[model samples]
Target: MARKKTDQKGDRLESIRDAHNAEKMARTTRMEDYLEVIYELIQHKGYATTVDISNYLNVSSPSVTKMLQRLSESGHVNYEKYRGITLTEAGVAVAKNMHDRHGVLAEFLMMIGVDEDTANRDAEGIEHHLHPETLKKLEEFVKLAKNQGLFR
Candidate 1:
């Protein structure tokens, strides 16, 4: 039988590495999602409100407020209570990046015969985690496939 609790004591040495990376991805994902919604709202409607964002994202109003406050603190948006929300330049850059990523992934999936709605949904799910190199290759494949009339 496996030794159930070996007597070797836990290490007394220092921790191996920093703890920033895991949380970084989570935080970045949240930031990107919020920014993407805000960007779409602004693009189509000329304004973004907490209620609109909450509705688009399907999060509670309070949750949206809390996140907006955090984003305000981070220089991603100009948020004022009951006023309005606007993405700063930095925020616009990130949001536009996510939007482009979504477009590419969805188009690629559709090129592979996935339906449009499912391609878009799956793109939203996975767009945040793609590496730059992998995304570049997929983008290239989609571009060439379209141009060469291979997937059409």
Candidate 2:
């Protein structure tokens, strides 16, 4: 029947959308983690090696290499065979955004009486899921709290 075929087509489209969403989420999370780590390492050490990233993330070297390759292909980083990793401008922008998001979340948690360690831990988990509008609101809240001496 025509109706049955239409329903099947709709189902297929829905399935495709769901799969695409899942893939995008996974990629976003991965890129966020890698960029953040690379940013920190480069800030501290002037370069980020695959071994350093592997150790920092507790992932294997090969895994880090694979992800770094993907990141390089995505124009996020410049990867060389044995030199080190460097964030491209796009990568730096992403890393900076992620870092700011983490800081705002952690500060908010601390302002609300969460311990430093717990605040950092919780912020890391919460930062990736927040929308831009939600993060903007949070930033405003933190500013207000700071003005009120709530963080002290």
**26, model 2: CA deviation in Å?**
8.3
For model 2, the run of ten residues with the poorest summed lDDT: 19-28
Deviating ranges (above 4 Å) for candidate 2? 1-27
TM-score of each: 0.83, 0.83
lDDT of each: 0.87, 0.90
**lDDT, candidate 1, residue 73?**
93
For model 2, which pairs clash?
none
lDDT of 1 at 55: 94
lDDT of 2 by residue, 1-152 (tens): 99999999999999889867875865578778989999999999998999999998899999999999999999999998797899999999999998999999999999889999999999998888776898999999889988997776
lDDT by residue (23-77, candidate 1, tens digit) is 4645578778999999999999999998998898999999999999999998999
Model 1 residue 90 CA deviation (Å) reads: 0.3
How high is the lDDT of residue 69 in model 2?
92
CA-only RMSD, every prediction:
6.7, 6.6
Residue-pair clashes per prediction, in order, are 0, 0
